[model samples]
Target: MLYHCFLLIASLRSVVAMETCPTTGMPGIPGIPGMPGRDGREGEKGEKGQPGAVLHGGLDLQKGEKGAPGMMGYAGKRGQNGEPGKSGSSGIAGPPGQPGDPGAVGVQLKAAFSVARGTHEFPQKASIIRFTKVITNINDDYDTESGRFRCRVPGAYYFVFHASLGNKLCVLMKLDQTLIASFCDHRYRRQQVTSGGLAVYLSRNQEVWMETKDYRGMRGQQNGHSIFSGFLLHPH
Candidate 1:
């Protein structure tokens, strides 16, 4: 006994130091959850994090559903012709046109004539002074057996004559073979009375006569002392 083996090694080191010492007591009743362990191999992507701090005053957002019509865009190059517009001020004048219908009733042209000389003969050089007294040949345009007047209406006439010379005469008045008027009485055994006139413009069977350059006098008077007249002063 070496002192009874040192008191049995000091009572087995005080029972192994009270079974390795760590016991503050009461926290041991939660342990029956254990079947979730196999998922741990995905961890390397973390270094880009520093930009998120500008959000001041939020809360007002309910109006957003109109967006589905966008696919027709390739036609834009026709824009260079627009500079000519400044002339507008003049419009007001229309009212007055209605009155037309009533016309047709004219033509009444009536030429005239009057003749005398019923022969006391003394007119025969370039002779054409016949007249057997008609005294008013309305449109029988005078031709008392060809002492001519013939111009059955074409314009401006008015001829006239009156001669009753008794000796030397020389009258003329023609118009076709034109020499409109003349008269010379030469008094040789005078019994004078002479006259002549004209205002011609005939054309339409044109004639008109009274020619005796000098085949001496004439005194044909049955109250009409040698005459010749014409009229129609209008129609052309």
Candidate 2:
């Protein structure tokens, strides 16, 4: 009886070993996916995704725009200064500036005058011809009382004069008693007009004026036809 019981127990053990248990975990091997559920009636859209980094791929792959630039990196320490280079040889000196046009000497002397007391003829005596129109008188160098320009600056000057004569007229221009220019008309038959100019070096206080040869010969016309002008050309 004991031997029979032992044999029965052995047989039962063998049968239990041969029998397998149902699998209780994920499938050991991939199984055919079940037909997707009817997508469960479209769910609410998910939150937007964060921006991505700049992509480095074919142009076709870069559908999305480039991402914002990365934050600037921390500044680096300054580098040591480099050694100075050797000085180059001195450059050739420039040609002496063309003497600079005498710098326009600062003397401001200019004047223009016309006969004063119209219709009043001058005397035969070598007298100063006064002027009425004080067109321009700088430094008061020209006198309207006594038609004359007294040189205040020692420099070369230019002078001009105009005279209208009806009868025989003779006008002489004198620079401090020195004859400069003369305008004469011996033809007492017709009217005559004369214009003249001169440039001369004048010393300080030298006077310039005109004198009539004959008072009756040089009669003043109602229309002012006499003028005198002068200006410093250049200072010595």
Candidate 3:
């Protein structure tokens, strides 16, 4: 029995070595890389996630190129009128202007005349000697026939006169019965000449003229040497 048992055990050991067992086999040469397996079935569709947040406080983005303008839209309805605005406050007053310069000198009222008529007589009472010739009479204040100048204004006036006589003669300048000036012949001569002048302020409508109370008559040879003249220097 003992001999049989030993034989059997040795046979069992030989069988194990020759036969392969799944779990205890030697690793084979790396497999011929496997024939690839089929792709897995597609996965189920996933749920949509929440919206992302807006980024801030980062480097500035470059400006994009401008886009083409859009087509114009239709005109809109008219709007209601707006209310009127309130009036503004008044501004402060400005400074006063400077005074203007004195006005220019007034129009000159003046006259100049020469004796043109022949020598004529005069009464003992003062008589006017007519100066028939006129050199200039502004405003026509002097009358050659009347031998009078009617003052048109109340103002200072200047008068000048010259008389020429064939014989002894005397001539006087009267302003409204007031003898303003006079000239008289000095002595018997072929032509005696005398001249007189005056400056006086006369009221409106006062008269001035040449006159002689005691002389036979004034004499003039119809020459410009015998002259009568007056002018307004300034008005009151």
Candidate 4:
């Protein structure tokens, strides 16, 4: 009986295993890690990559050395003229100049005449009074025969005349044929005196004389004298 029971139990276990395993048991514990592997061989150099993009951020570089001077360039053409500038202020005056040399001596020009009437005689109308007496006659410009003065020097001259008149007198001083001055005096039954003077510019060879406008009234010698006088003021 004991042997048979043992056999029966073994048979039951075998049949149970053969049919299917019971629910699986819990997993086993993990194993420890292995030693590290050695490094692999370096790879082959890749083809030159495309140029990289410019990076803003980079290491700062040192300053570069100074460059050599360049060659001289050709001269440029002249530019156009600019507008006129404002005038400058006047400068200070300069010192005075040196004194000049003295001038040469000049020639002296002289002409003068003075004449008086000697006799008391009535003169004809429109005729020159002939003064026979001569008080002074420089350069002999006055002619006693014609009773006229011919200008030898072109100049300004001063002429004066005085007449001793009896009854009535009218005398005219003339330059050439032109009347320059006149004097008339009338005092009935009484003696009187008349005088005239003029300053004239005369050219060379121009004539001057005194004449009576009327035939009457001249007194000289015993009475007051009639005189004509002239002198050069300056040569032209």
Candidate 5:
């Protein structure tokens, strides 16, 4: 039995060896070389991918919450800019004003007169003495007494003088030393024989007087009369 087992083992080994070294086909001859390949065209674009698809084996995560809107995106890169605006219109003018009032007047007055004084004479009594008005009085009759008359006030002045005797009379009037009028008669009563008006510009401290051109008491019948008055020559 041992002998048979040995032979059986040898036979199985030989069979395994044969199975390991199996026969192959005969070698074939070399084939001809192939031609050069043509140039290749570009590949077609791939389709758009889904919103959140997995890449390789990685997990497909959802997009995060959108943040606040960015500062308005810097004004959208300005368009083809437009031209500048036109200027505004000018304003209207104002109205004119009203007229003004008239102006005021200036100062004026009388001055002086020589009622009975002589302009030229040699101690002639009861002589014809002329009278006239003077802008500046040069005689001694102009008085600046406290309460009497204002011998200084200026304006036009009027003077009158009359010489009277028992029944004889004579009168004279003057303006600015220029004889203006004279009255003489033998038959006369107490009347304005001489009278005249004068316009003068008498300043302060001037003088005026009156004298007997003819007498009425005895020399030519003796006493004579005289007077002076003042008024404004022009409006102020």
Candidate 6:
């Protein structure tokens, strides 16, 4: 019919282009790089958003209500008494005070004796003697009013003599005039006559005297019994 309908429309367009494109010929020049694609599965969590309400849209800022604590503040006026403290640096002179103890040696005394006033039952000059003083003024002790025997403290001095004479008389003790002690022809108070201690070194003016010999107790009744005492010693 028109060529079998144009040969059945060209054989149904060649079987509908060979069932549409079996290897559509003319498209094959890009094939050398194809093995890489496998990692994409994670995306699901998004729902939370609601908090925004503070909008005081104002224009008069007047906070005025705290004004009652202002009535107790009046006591701060005493600050002018601090200017007298500058005298503290004089303490370094205390190491020179230690020496006081040595004062004890002061003793003095004086005395002398010789009393026999009269009755010369036998007298040969020595009225009644006993005297020995002068050891640097021996600490004296016996001065029946200037009978002599004095030395307040100087050293060595001693004298002792006692005598009676109605039948005896010869005792003496003297210094300066020499002769120290002596007794002879004794016999009184039954018999007692002594005159034998005499050592001198008297000072402090010095003095000592005593005498008695005998005319047999000078005139009578025991002429003048001798007697004398004086002493002082401290130097061996």
Higher-lDDT candidate of 4 and 6? 4
Better of 5 and 6 by lDDT: 6
Candidate 1's C-alpha runs over 4 A off are: 1-107, 119-132, 139-156, 162-164, 167-186, 189-195, 200-218, 221-225
Tens digit of per-residue lDDT, candidate 6, span 32-71: 8988989899889888889875445555565557877778
Model 4 RMSD in Å is 22.3
Candidate with the larger TM-score of 5 and 6? 5
Tell me how many clashing residue pairs each candidate has: 0, 0, 0, 0, 21, 33
TM-score of 3: 0.48
Q: Which 10 consecutive residues of model 2 have the lowest summed lDDT?
A: 108-117
What is candidate 5's lDDT per residue for 191-221, written digit by digit as tens? Answer: 4243444444444544333323464321221
Best by TM-score: 4
Q: Residues 69-92, candidate 3: write the lDDT tens digits.
A: 999999999999999999999999
List runs of model 3 lying over 4 Å from the truth. Answer: 1-105, 108-126
What is the model-wide C-alpha lDDT for candidate 4?
0.84
Model 2: which residue pairs collide? none
Estimate the TM-score of every prediction. 0.23, 0.47, 0.48, 0.52, 0.25, 0.21
Candidate 1 achieves a global lDDT of 0.79
lDDT string for model 2 (156-211, tens) is: 98887776655566777899888998877676665566667889889888999877
Best by lDDT: 4
Worst 10 residues of 5 by lDDT: 115-124
User: What RMSD does each model have against the real structure?
Assistant: 24.5, 20.3, 21.8, 22.3, 25.4, 23.8
Worst 10 residues of 3 by lDDT: 115-124
